[model samples]
Target chain A: MPLKLFELVGRDAARPFSPYCWRTRMALAHKGLSADTIPWRFTEKSVLVPYGSERVPVMLDGDRAVVDSWAIANHLEDAYPDRQSLFGGAGGRAMARFINSWGDIAILGGISPLVLADIPKLLDQVDADYFRTSREARFGKPLEEVMATRDQAVIGFRRSLEPLRQTLKAQPFIGGDAPDYADYIVFGGFQWARVVSPFKLLEETDSVYAWRERLLDAFDGLARKSPGFPV
Target chain B: MPLKLFELVGRDAARPFSPYCWRTRMALAHKGLSADTIPWRFTEKSVLVPYGSERVPVMLDGDRAVVDSWAIANHLEDAYPDRQSLFGGAGGRAMARFINSWGDIAILGGISPLVLADIPKLLDQVDADYFRTSREARFGKPLEEVMATRDQAVIGFRRSLEPLRQTLKAQPFIGGDAPDYADYIVFGGFQWARVVSPFKLLEETDSVYAWRERLLDAFDGLARKSPGFPV
Candidate 1:
């Protein structure tokens, strides 16, 4: 049986845009495997009840069901030992945990305010309503207001990426000579931002921008082939 | 001949306290190797001219000289392969680079304002003058002014460590169950802070505080045994 993945989508089921989901997508591609996408939406919580998860990016591999992006990545690596390794070795796996934390905070959290308001426009009416209400409650303000100063806030967002920029100065990928799960952990956020918002999160001259372009070209341009803005 | 490391010190030559040097110190101890310390002061740049570095932590192993903490760590790993691996594997070596960057910025750079002023007090008159002149020029203010609001600014420094705190929630060490070079990368900074400052950088309730305690106890209390402020 082919692997199946529950992935997040908006108005267009073809464009799966959750950063966590993107991590799994890249991992599967890196392993030279494919998963049949079970397109999911924000309001479709009941559909995921069988999978025991309230979020998308849940992976179903035969009898095993894995929830959470980090868990799913580990599952893929362990389950497919014969394929290209997700982490280079035991040390890489441990160190990548730190990177995973960084990706969550610096990459995903940092990008949220810059592109959040734009996300609602891509959702259908119900998901848009659910997303706006839930997110606004989390931020304690309207999404529009939160994103109002994104033009200026992006400078700090760019600055927050200094460690990543510094890393890329010596390496072409976070995984060293080639892209690995570490690259996917971070690219997931940039890719998600690209799918939902037209905001340019990186400067063309930045090493991070060049790294993203390389990932966009990975797996036969798998991410680039998805429907999204040119950004 | 034993390996000789030129390490930064103040009036108390026995308390070698440069963060970079501490990284190499911990790494050397991890490899179960010992190096004799050549206590160095800020004004003694001309003494290190033959080593081709303007910094401390220049390690001389027999006829070979290694400079910089990161390079020294790599040198130790490669030169002493029969010992425990500094990086778990090739992937670990690559990913650790990112952690090294974060260590330099978040751990070392983050602790600077809170502890920098305390450093000059540890130095003698000549080195103290050079430290105040150079560092004040770098910060564009007196060290006292920069550190004045640190009691409040420490909250932000603590916040910057959130990612590291998140990582420790899962693994015992950044390098996994046992401490590795990655753990040493960040611990070197905390050890540096403890050596010079009385200011508390971590809340006792925080996981990071626990992690620091564990690292200090590693290699038979190598860091804890060093002379420093109680904090």
Candidate 2:
């Protein structure tokens, strides 16, 4: 059986937008493998219940089921050892965990408030309601209120990218001379923001902007070709 | 010729406090290598002028001069490839750069204000004058004023450490399973703080605090043996 990946999407199934899913998507491309994309909506937890996970980016590799983006990335690397290595080496694998944590907290968490309101617009009525209600409870405010200060909050968001910016100043990618799982780890957050929101998360002059553009152009413009706002 | 390292110190010659220098110090130990430490004070620019750089952690491996902690690390890795690998591989080498950047900006930068005033107390008269003048110029305020809000500002510093904390939650070290350059990169900042200040950077309950303790015990308590304030 062909590998199948449950990807988070909204009204437009073509635009899979979960940051975690994007991480797995980029990892699959890096490994020179392809999976049949199963567009999964936010409110559709029942679809993943059988897989023992409520998250998208759940990968079914023949008989085995893999859940979580990090686990899926590790699974892809181990299962497809002959393909291009997702992690350059064991050291890279360990350090990538730190990058993953930073990406989740600094990148994903930072971008959430900036794009929270824009997200519901991309969802259908039911998914939008679910998204807003769940997110509002998490933020302790309505989506609109959460995003009310985004224009100013985005400044902090951009400032938080200083480590990435400083790193890019010395090397072309986080994986140094070439893009690796570490790059994918961070790019996933940007790709998620681009797919859902029109708000500019990065300035045109920012090195991070150029880095994102390069990733968008990677794999024959795979990410850029995907349906998303022009960020 | 034996390896020589210029280590930043204040009044006490045995106590090296610069975060970048601590990174090199730990990297050297990780490689099972030793260096003759040349204690450097803040006002001692003339001492480094012969090395063609004005920084601590300037390493002289024979006639070759390596400046910057990162450069010194790369130099050590390349020159002593047979030793335990500082970077596990090329991929690790690349990603460690990101960790290095995060260590500098997030960890070191976050701790600076909290410990800024305490630093001068560790310096001699001339060095303290140089430190205050130079640091005040950069911060655009008196060091005391900068540190005045630290009791409150340390909360932000702890929050900024969430990435490291989260990573440590899953792995024993940033290098995973064992300490490596990535661990040294972050531990350097904490070590720097420990050397110069009694300020509590991490609560005893934090996983990061535990991680620091493990590092302190690494290389047979090399870091713990060094002269520093009890943190």
Candidate 3:
């Protein structure tokens, strides 16, 4: 049996919109591995409970189940050593931990408010209600209110990507010459925003925009083929 | 004959506190290569003009002059391949470009406001005048004003370090298990602050603070032995 991955989607099972899940998807492709997608949704907590995870990107390889995207990436790298490395090497694997954190805090955290309101439109009624309720409880506001100032907020978000911008300017990718898990970790956030919302997270003039175009075309247009708003 | 490094120093000359210079210093020590320190000051631009650059971290190895800390690091890595690797490997080296950028923007840029006011105290009158004028011209404000709200500004600065904090929390160093050029890139900023100012940049409870302490104690307390305020 092929490996199986629980990927978070919404009304359209074909669209895996979770940033964390996209990270796993890219990692699997990078490692030349394929997994049957088990489309997940916000209200699908019961299915994940059996996998001992409350999240998408739960990768089931044989008898072992990996819960987190980071864990899944590691598992893919270690298990498929003969395949292309997700992290270039041990050092990259180490530093990628920082990149993963940056993706979560700077990318995912930064882009959340910019697109959260649009996400409900992609979800079924039950999932949409669950998402709005959970997110509102967490943020103490409605999703639309949370993302109300996204136009202005996006300027700051673009500025926050300066480090990534500078790095991309001098090199083709964060992985240097080629894309790696560091690139995937960050690109996953962009993919999430693209798939669920029509927001323009990156400007056309940005080196980040160019890098994103490269990634969108990476792995035989794997990410581009997935259902998403035009970046 | 040992290698020679043009390091930025203040009036005392013993304190080399330029963040970029400190990066070269740490990289040298990591490579287990020693260099005779040639103290340079802000007004010493003419000397560096002959070096083809106006940077303090102008490293002279044999007859060739390597300017810029990043260039010097790459030179050392390629030149001394037999010694300790500054970047773990090719991937580590590549990802480090991003870390280098984060160090510049988030580390050096964030800490500037907190410590810029105090830097004049450590510089000679000539250097101080040059420093203030150039920086004021750049920022379009008096140095004190630039740094006036540091107490409140530091809260945001600390929060901005979430990525580094998260990275250190999971691993001993960005290089993992041991320190590397990536560690030096970030630590150089702290060393610069420690040498030039008395302000506390990290809280005792912070993982970043602990990581700084470990780095300070690395290479036989190399950074600790330098003239600096208690971290």
Q: Write candidate 1's Cα lDDT for B36-109 as tens digits.
A: 99999999999889989999889999999998998999999999999999999889999988999999888888
State the fnat of candidate 1 relative to the true structure.
Answer: 0.88
TM-score of each: 0.99, 0.99, 0.98
Task: For each candidate, give the TM-score of chain B.
Answer: 0.98, 0.98, 0.98
By lDDT rank, best first, the candidates go: 2, 1, 3
lDDT of each: 0.93, 0.93, 0.92
Q: Tell me how candidate 1 scores on lDDT.
A: 0.93
lDDT of 3: 0.92
DockQ of 1: 0.90
Kindly list the per-residue Cα lDDT of model 3 for residues A21-76, writing each as its tens digit.
99999999898889999988888789988888888889989999999999999999
Candidate 1 CAPRI grade: high
Give the CA lDDT, 0 to 100, for residue A86 in model 3. 83
- Candidate 3 per-residue lDDT, tens place, B115-193, comes to 9989989899999999999999999999999999998999999999999888877898999999889999999999999
> Residue B48 deviation, candidate 1, in Å?
1.5
lDDT of 2 by residue, B16-119 (tens): 99999999999999999999999988888998898889878899999999999999999999999999999899999999999999999989999999999999
Q: Residue B112 CA error for candidate 3 (Å)?
A: 0.3
